[model samples]
Target: MPVVLSLNVARKTIPVDYARAGATGIDKRPVDGPLRVSPTEAKGTAGSGVAGDSIGDWTVHGGEYQAVYGYAREDLDWWQSELDVPLSNGQFGENLTTQGIDHTTALVGEHWRIGSALLEVTGPRIPCRTFAEFLGQRGWVKRFTQQARPGAYFRVLEEGLIGPGDEISVVHRPGHDVTVELCFRALTTEAALLPRLLAAGDSVPPEVVELVHKRSVVELDS
Candidate 1:
């Protein structure tokens, strides 16, 4: 079973001097004990799980489609060697630092039951300026894009208490080829795969679907 290695949250703090300094909710710290996990009631607000885990910019971050972000411990370990930097849980601002899960191959509509809440994999996290500034890495966005290991975002389906060490398991997987990595590729490197995202339905947020369609139209017209 996949398990949560750490549950993270952060207090809203003063911004530091960086591209993301003005960003409101990028910092997160690991938390222990039981945390509530539930859907966000509005955009830009903390979602149900782990109270006080805030999103700096709700317009772009928190929402039903992006209520909780999960990054695999294996991915973090890989980055540790690549960057030669000390990495820790919540380093990526992910709500759940998970273990024993292949996030790259996670299907967009796959479901996971952790503690009492059920979560649906929504899509791959798109790296942003805030994320880049938080890491303070040079050429960070491009490097991250090239890695193509962006973590997965999830929507809470069932509200419940969750904590570190809770068992995580796939409860359902939509019969579609739209894995998180593939979805990320379709949006970033492989515009030709845009049409394929249509197969994902709600798993791919409607805004993304529209963007893909617009891009596809531009490609055909060009």
Candidate 2:
């Protein structure tokens, strides 16, 4: 059974050279029990869905579709071995560091029941300059994109509280082959996979859907 390994929340923003805001809430720390999960009051203005978790860059980071970020502990362990550096939970700006779950293979629109909250997988976390800078790794964005294990973001469907050690139950899964990894590849390195993302229906992000439509039109014209 999948379980929450750590419940991380950024206590405050810290200065960073990469972010447009000149500060980032990427330095999240694990916290003890009962964190509230809910929709933000406004998109691109308010912060994270998890109460007390700060979002320094509201313009792109926090919104209805990206309310919470989850990263697999297995992935972190892999990175630790690859980089020869010890990594901790929340190191990658994820609010939930999970265990026993393959987040990349999770289907889009899959429903997870954690504690009393219901969260629906919305999309993948796109690697940004901030992420690269945070990790202090050269070519981190390109490397992460190539790896295609870009974790997963979720939208709060039923507000409730979540905590470390809470069991994560997959209450529902969409009937599609569009896993988070596939969507990431389509949006990043493999434009050829864009058409396949349509099978996921409205569960795919609207921006990605628009890109797919435009690509189809271009192909038709050609």
Q: How far is candidate 2 from the true structure (C-alpha RMSD, Å)?
A: 1.4
165: Cα error in model 1, Å: 0.5
Q: List the residue pairs that clash in candidate 1.
A: 9-29, 24-56, 25-56, 36-49, 37-49, 38-48, 38-49, 44-58
Which runs of model 2 end up more than 4 angstroms from their true locations?
Answer: none
Compose the digit string of candidate 2's lDDT tens values, residues 118-186.
999988999999999999999999999988889999989999999999999999988889999988998
TM-score of each: 0.92, 0.95
Q: For model 1, how does the per-residue alpha-carbon lDDT over 129-180 read when each residue is reduced to its tens digit?
A: 7778788898888899999999998988888888999999899999999999
Clashes of 2: 0
Model 2 residue 49 lDDT? 95
* Model 2 TM-score, all chains together: 0.95
- List the lowest-lDDT window of 10 residues for candidate 1: 41-50
